[model samples]
Target: MRILYVITPSRLSGAERMLLRMARVQQRHGDSVRVLSKPLDAFERAAADDGIEMVTGAIGGKLNLRACPTIVEHIQRFAPDVVLTMHSTGTLWGVRAARKAGVPCVALMQAANTRWPYTTAPAAVGCAEFVRQHLIAGGMSPDRVYAIPNGIEPEPYLDDEDRDRARSDLGLTPSDLAVGTLAHFTPRKAHSDLLDAAAIVTRSVPELVLLWAGEGPLETKLRQQAARLGLADRVRFLGYRTDAPRLHRAFDIFALPSLLEGLPLAVLEAMASARPCVVTAVSGNPELVDDGVTGYLVPRRNPQVMAQALIRLATNDEARRTMGLAGRKRIMEMFTLDGLMQRLREVLEREIRRQRGPGG
Candidate 1:
C-alpha cells in the first residue's frame, strides 16, 4: 500500500516517533511510504536517515487556513493510496486535503486525551482504547475508530551484548541498580513527582541511581526540584537521547509518573528490555502493566505512593527480576512491531477494499 504520514514536528516527541516507526515498517514491507511534517525537526531527520522520504512544509496549526492547497498539491504529486494524519489540530486540514486529492485518509489520535480529531477524519486510530473512545465522543463512528496500541522493534533493546557494552560505556557498576525514566522534563510527565519519590526511595537504598533521559520545557525547574529534594547526587539528567532502547538496557527498573499517556513507546521499550516498570495509573498504562504482577502502578501525581512502590521493588531482588520477566513475556505476547504492522495491514487493506467496492 502507498501511505503518507503527516505530523507537526517541533520536537522528536512520542507522536512523531510513532510516525517514523510506521514509515520504517511500511517501507520495509515494500510499501511506498513518505512523511510530511510542518518543519524539518529532528524526528524528520531521523526518518530521512532511515531512508524514508521526509517532506516538510508550513502546513501547521497557524497556517491551516492557507495551507490546504499546498497540502493537496503534495498529495497529488505523491499519489498515495492513503494519508494518515497525526496531531489533533492538523487532522481536519490533512484529511480535507487528501479528500480533495481523491484519496482515503486516516487520522491517528496520538494523545490519550483529545477533544477533537474524531469528527475530522473518515477513520481514526489511537494507541489506547481510552483514546479511541475520546475520539468517538467527539463524534466519529465506532466502526471507523481503531484502538491500536504502540509497539516496539525490540531488537535494539534486547541486545545482551549492547547491555554489557552500554553499562561499560556509562561506567555503571555491575551491582548498581539503575532506575531510569525516558520522558521530557515536563509537568505532564511529572518529573518533579519522580524526583520527590526518588528522594524517599534512595534513603532506604543508598546505592540506587536514577537517570532522567529527556529534555523539555521544564528541565530547569525539574533540576531545581531534584536539588531541593537532595537527590542531585543520585539523579543524573541525560538530555534528549535517540538511543533510548540501548539506554533502557542499562537500567534495572523504569519508572514513569505521567499525568497522562497513550501507551507510551518508552514504557513499551522498557518492557521489551525485560526491565521492571513502575508507572502512574493513567490512560493505557494499566492495560500494559498488571499492577503488582508485571510491575507497579501508583496514583498519578502522588509522590508518596510512587516512593512506596519504588521501595517495594528496590528491597526485593527476586520480585524485581520476576516482574521484569513478566513484562518481557507480555511484550512478546501482545506488543511487538510485527504484530502492530499486521493489524494495520489488515485495517488498511480492508479500507482500500471497501473504498474499491465489491466488484474490484
Candidate 2:
C-alpha cells in the first residue's frame, strides 16, 4: 500500500509526532509512506530518520496558492493509494488537490472543542468520537467518518535508577511531589489554570513542584502570571524539550488542565509511564482517564477543583500507585502503536481495494 500524509507544520507538535510514528510503522509494514509538508525542521528530520520521504510544500494563510501546483504534481507523480490530510484548515486544499489527481483523500479532524469548517472529502477521520459526531452533524455523511484515536509506542518503564538520573538532570529532588504537564502554552491548553491550581497545591503541599513543558506564543505572559501568583519558585517553565518521555518518567504525577483536548498524546505518554494522572474533564480525556479509577478528572478551567484532585493523588501514595498501575494497564490494552497502525492500514487498504474494484 502507498500512503501520502499531508500536514501544515514543520515543527514538532502532538499531531506531527503522531504522524512521524505512523509513517515509521506503515513503512515497517511494507507500506510506501511519505509526507508533504513545509520546510524541514526537527519534526521533518525525525520523519526522514524514519524513512518517510518529505516533499517541501508551504501553505500560508489557510489557502495559499503557492503550493497548489507542487501538491498536484506530487499526487500525480506518486499516485498513492491513500492521501491522509491532517489539520482541518489544510484539508480543503489537500482534498481538492487529491481529487484533481483522481486519488482518495481522508481528512483527520484532530480538534476536540473547536468546530472547524470541514471540507467535503472522500472520508474524514477523527481522533475522538466527539469530533467525528460533530463532523457528521455538520453535513458529513456518517459512513464517511471514522473515530480512530491517537496512539503511541510504549517501551518498558525506566527503572528507579534511570528515573533518578532524569530527576537529577532536571534539578528535581526525590522529596518533591513533582506534577508535570507537556502541553503548548495556549489558552486552549489552559496553562494559566494549571499554574493557579499549582499555587493551590503549594498551599497544601509545600513540597510540590509543577513542571510545564513545551513552548508557544504565551510563554512570556504565562511567566508573568506565575510571578504574580507567587508561584515562580514552584512552577518551572521547561521550554520545549524533545525528550518528553524521559521527562514523563521523572514525574510522580501528571496533570493536564486543558480547556479542550482531542485525546492528548502527552496524557497517553504519562499513562504509559505509570504515573497517576489528573486531567480536566473535556473532549476525549474522560474516555482515556477512567476518572476515579485510572486517574482523576476535574472540571475544565477550574483550578480549585484541579488543586483538590492533585492533593488527593499527591498525599495518598496508595491511591496514586493504584491509579498509575491502572493507567499503564489501560494504555497497553487500548492505545498501543501496533493496534492503531493496524486499524489505519485496514482503512487505507480497504479504501484502495474498493477504489480498484474487480475489473481492469
Candidate 3:
C-alpha cells in the first residue's frame, strides 16, 4: 500500500509523535509511506532517522486556497492509495486536495473537544472512543468514523540501566522522589496547576522534586512562576528532551494535569516505562488509567486534589511499584504498536475496498 500522510506541525507534540510512529510501523510492514509537512527541526531529524520519505512545504493558513493546488500536485505525483491527514488544517486541505485528485482521504482525529470544519472525507480515524463518539455527535456518519487508540513499542521504555543513568545525570539522589511530566509547556496542559500541586505536595514531602521535560512558549513565564512560588530549587525544567523515554526512569510518578487531551502519548509512554501516572480526568484519560489501579485520576485544574494524589504515590513506595507494574501490564495487553498497526491496516484496507467497489 502507498500511503501519504499530511500534517502541519509547529512542534513535536503527541499527535506528531504518533504520526512518526505510525509511518515507521507501516513502512516496516512493507507499506510505502510518505509524509508532507513543514520542516520543523525535531520532526525533520526524527523522520529522516526513521528512513521515512518526507516532502517539506508550508500549509499556509487554515483556509489557504492557494496551497490546495500545491497539495493536489503532490497527490498526483505520489499516486497514493490513500491520503491520511493529522488534524484540522491538514484535514481541511488534504481532503480538498485528495477530492480534487480523486483519491481516498482519511482524517486522523486527535482531539475530542475541538470540532473539525470539513466532514466530507470518506473516513475519519479517532485515537480513542471519545473522539469517535465526538465525530459522530458532530454529524459525521457513524460508519465513517473508526476508533483506534494510540500505541507504542514497549522495548525502548524498558531499560533499567538507562533509567539509572538518566536519574544520576539529573542529579537525583536515591532519597529524593521525582514527580515528572513530558508535555509541551502550554496553557491547556495546565503546567501552572501542576506547579501549584507541587507546592502543596512538597510542603508535606520535602524530598519531592519536579522534573518537567519539553519546551514551548510558556517556558519563561513558568520559570518565573516557579521562582515566585519559591519552587525554583525543586522544579527542574529540562527543555525538549530527545531522551524522554529514558527520563521516565528518573520519575517516581508521572504527572499530567492537562485541561484537555485526546489519549496523550506521554501518559502511555510513562505507563510503558512501568511508572504510575497522576493525570487529569478528561477525555481518553479514564480509558487508560484504571483510577487507583493503574494510576490515580484527579479533576482538571484542582491543585488540592492533584497534590493529594501525587503525595500518596510519592510517599508510598510499595503502592507506586504495584500501580506501575499494573500500568505496564495494561499497556502490554491492549496498546502495543503492533495492535495499533493491525487496526490501521484494517481501516485502510476497508476504505480502499470501499473506494474500489466490487473488486475493481
Candidate 4:
C-alpha cells in the first residue's frame, strides 16, 4: 500500500515522533510511504533514514487555502492509495486537496483537549477514544471517526546494572528518588504544576529529585519558576533529550502533570521501560494508566493532589515495583507498536475500499 502523510510540525514532539515511527514500520513492511510537511530538520532526517520520501512545502496559518493546490500537486504526483492528514492546518487543506485529486483522506486527530478544524473532514482516526468523541461532538459523524490509540515498542526489562548506569550518566545518585517527566515545557504540559508539586513533595521526601526533559518556548520562564518555588536545586531541566529509553531507565517513577494529552507517547515510553506513571486524569491518560493499579491519576492542574501521589510512591518501594511491572505488562499486552499499526493499516484499507465502492 502507498500512503501519503500530511502534517506541518514546528518541532519533533509526541505526535511527530509517533508518526515517524509509523512511517518506519510501514517502510519495513515494504509499503511506499511519503510525507508532506514543513522543513523540520529532525523529521526530515528521520524520514531520510527510514527510506521515506519527504515532500517539503509551506502549510501555514489557520485557513490554508493557498496550500491546497500545492497539496493537490503532491497528491496527483504521488498517487497514493490514501492521504492521512495530521494537525489542524494539514487536515483543513489536505482534505480539500485530496478531494480535488479524487483520493481518499483521513484526518489523524492526535489531541482531544484542543479543538481543530475536524468537522468537515470525511474520515478521521483519533489517537484515543477521547479524541474520537471530541471529533463526534465537533459535528463529525461517529461512523467516520475511528479510535486507534498510539503505541510504542515495549523495552526489555531493565536490570539493576542498567538503571544504575543510566542514573549515573544523568548525574543522579542511586539514593535519590528520581521522578522524571518527558514533555515540552509548555502551558498545556503544565510543568509549573510539576514544579509546585515537587516543592511540596521535597518537604516530605527530601531525597526526591525532578528530571524535567524536552525543550519548548517556556524554558526560561520555567527555570525562573523553579527558582521562585525554591526547587532550583531539586529539579534538573535536561533540555531536549532524544534518548527516551535511557531517560526512562534512569527514572524510578515517571510523572506527567499535564492539563491535557492525546495518548502521550512519553508516558507510553516510560511505561514500556517498566516504570510507573503519575499523570493527570485527562484525555487518554486514564485509559493508559489504570489509576491505583498501574499508577496514580490526580486531577488536572492540582499540585497538592499530584504531590500526594508523588509522595505516596516515593516512600513505597514495593508499590513502585509492583506498579511498574504491571505498567510494562499492560504496554506489551495492549499497546505495542505492531498492534496499533495493524489497526491503522486496516482503517486506511477500509477507507480505500469504501472510496472504490462495489468492488470497483
What are the lDDT figures for the candidates, one per model? 0.83, 0.82, 0.88, 0.87
Tens-digit lDDT track of model 1 for 242-353: 8887798889899999998989998899988888999999988988988988899899989999989888998899998899889988998899888988998888887767
Ordered by lDDT, highest first, the candidates read 3, 4, 1, 2
- Clashing residue pairs in candidate 1 are none
Q: Give per-residue CA lDDT, model 2, range 26-94, as digits (tens).
A: 888788887888774786678767777888667533667765566788888888988888775457678
Kindly give the stretch of ten consecutive residues in candidate 2 with the minimal lDDT sum: 110-119
Estimated TM-score for each candidate? 0.95, 0.95, 0.97, 0.97
Tell me the deviation in Å of residue 99 in model 4: 0.5
lDDT of 3 at 315: 84
Cα RMSD of predicted structure 3: 1.2
Q: Model 2 Cα displacement at 211 (Å)? A: 1.0
Which predicted model would earn the best lDDT?
Answer: 3
For candidate 2, the per-residue lDDT at 20 reads: 83
| lDDT at 234, model 3 | 92
